[model samples]
Target: MSDASTNAGAGNGAAQTPVQPKMNILAQFIRDMSFENVLAQKGAKGETKPDIQVQVNLDARKRQTEGQYEVVMKLHITNKSKDSGDTLFLLELDYAGIFQVENIPDEQLHPFLLIECPRMLFPFARRIVADVTRDGGFPPLNLETIDFIALYRAELQRRQQAQAAAPATGQA
Candidate 1:
């Protein structure tokens, strides 16, 4: 009787063990980077501060390995002289990370890849931008923190709008 009860208890314990969601970053690195000081000596000599523009974009794709995905965060920055409207400097960087994610529902996977993975990779990318700018004989260009959730939502809206417009334009 005690042996039967022990077996029953073990079965119940196994049923109660829950499968936990998991996300692990396997690796991260700068896939590509380019920095150009268009004006060179002229840019350094200019006393006036240039207007700076920065753009951020995110993309993700599944890797060959199961449960593995690659996410890339691309940053484009440009500085232009306020008075002369000449290009001062331009920098572009593509930073990526390989992540292993499991137990996530299909509905939540897109957000996890677009929002969470990029959030994890942003700081390192930001630091590299700053360092590259400083090393190029200019003051560090510290990027502002990005709002991934908002960006993701905006991207969705933009795509929806484009799809809605496509059929209308095709008929014309």
Candidate 2:
């Protein structure tokens, strides 16, 4: 076989494959969680369609250990009655993960920490929401799949807008 075809010679002109990035979930935990059954507290509920809203936020910071980062996913869920406009339940959760990442470019690392790390931690966070709602005397809340790439883009846009407004507000 030719050296170029077999990639067996030092002088071969074949482009080398890029090194694959690596990430490891060293630990995951729930930093904080709260569930309030407002419907029960008010003692007023009878077969109303629930209007549910979920808000997710992500934060990441570097750890002392080399190539290690801590990412936190914060979830705020509110369920209100469609008929009465009263709150049914409120759930707030902060889930965090420690990840060891390697071989990723600095430009991409921020998005990877906010998007990919939370993507890995999502199932566990979803399950916790389901369990918490069910245990709190309501039907289980099965969260829909999240699009992390979109979330990351939205966050970038939000920050850019905020920065634009900051100078205008400062001048006011």
Candidate 3:
């Protein structure tokens, strides 16, 4: 093949390729946070096992600026004694980030926001949780890595089940 034809074919192939996803973090902050040391108030009498529970929720909204969106991660943590069923501590935190994104298809934006965006913010949120718990007069709480994809799928399944059940009960 001639050099001209070869260049033209390469150009066409490159043009058909999809653009890469782009994202920039404009800012990240803790929007709201609260920690309560229930054990301190109640007083620990003896050794007890800690039952810890963690819940994570994500939300995203568009900003006024073009291509700018805000993503928030809401984390709730609770600690209780397994032996006595006494509450040990409660932590609630809302961490948010301003993200400027490009090249993501409209159909994929929601999942990307809920999954990838929060995945980016998880380390910082985890650090905050550890700090707060330690400051509350307990051992530092090291959080486990979360699987955002699994969480999103479970949420979708939960919603589907609720919707499916709603119609069945409504007719009765």
Clashing pairs in 2: none
The segments of candidate 2 whose C-alpha lies over 4 angstroms from its true place after superposition are 1-16
Error of 1 at 117 (Å): 0.2
- 37-153: candidate 2 lDDT, tens digit per residue: 998898875698999999999999999999999999999999998888889999999999999999999999999998999999999999999999999999999999999999999
Candidate 1 vs candidate 2, lDDT winner: 2
Please rank every candidate by TM-score, starting with the best: 3, 2, 1
The models' CA-based lDDT, in order, is 0.93, 0.94, 0.94
Candidate 3 C-alpha lDDT tens digits along 1-172:
6999999999999999999999999999999999999888887666779999999988999999988999999999999999888889999999999999999999999999999999999999999999999989889999999999999999999999999999999999
Q: After superposition, how far is residue 42 of candidate 3 from its true place, in Å?
A: 1.8
Q: What is the Cα-based lDDT of residue 1 in candidate 1?
A: 100
Worst 10 residues of 3 by lDDT: 39-48
TM-score of each: 0.87, 0.89, 0.90
The positional error of residue 121 in candidate 1, measured at the CA in angstroms, is: 0.2
Candidate 1 structure quality by residue, lDDT tens digits, 24-128: 999999999999998784635748668999888999999999999999999989999899888888999999999999988889999999999999999999999
In Å, residue 3's CA in model 1 sits off its true spot by 16
Order of models, best lDDT first: 2, 3, 1
Model 3, runs deviating above 4 Å: 1-11
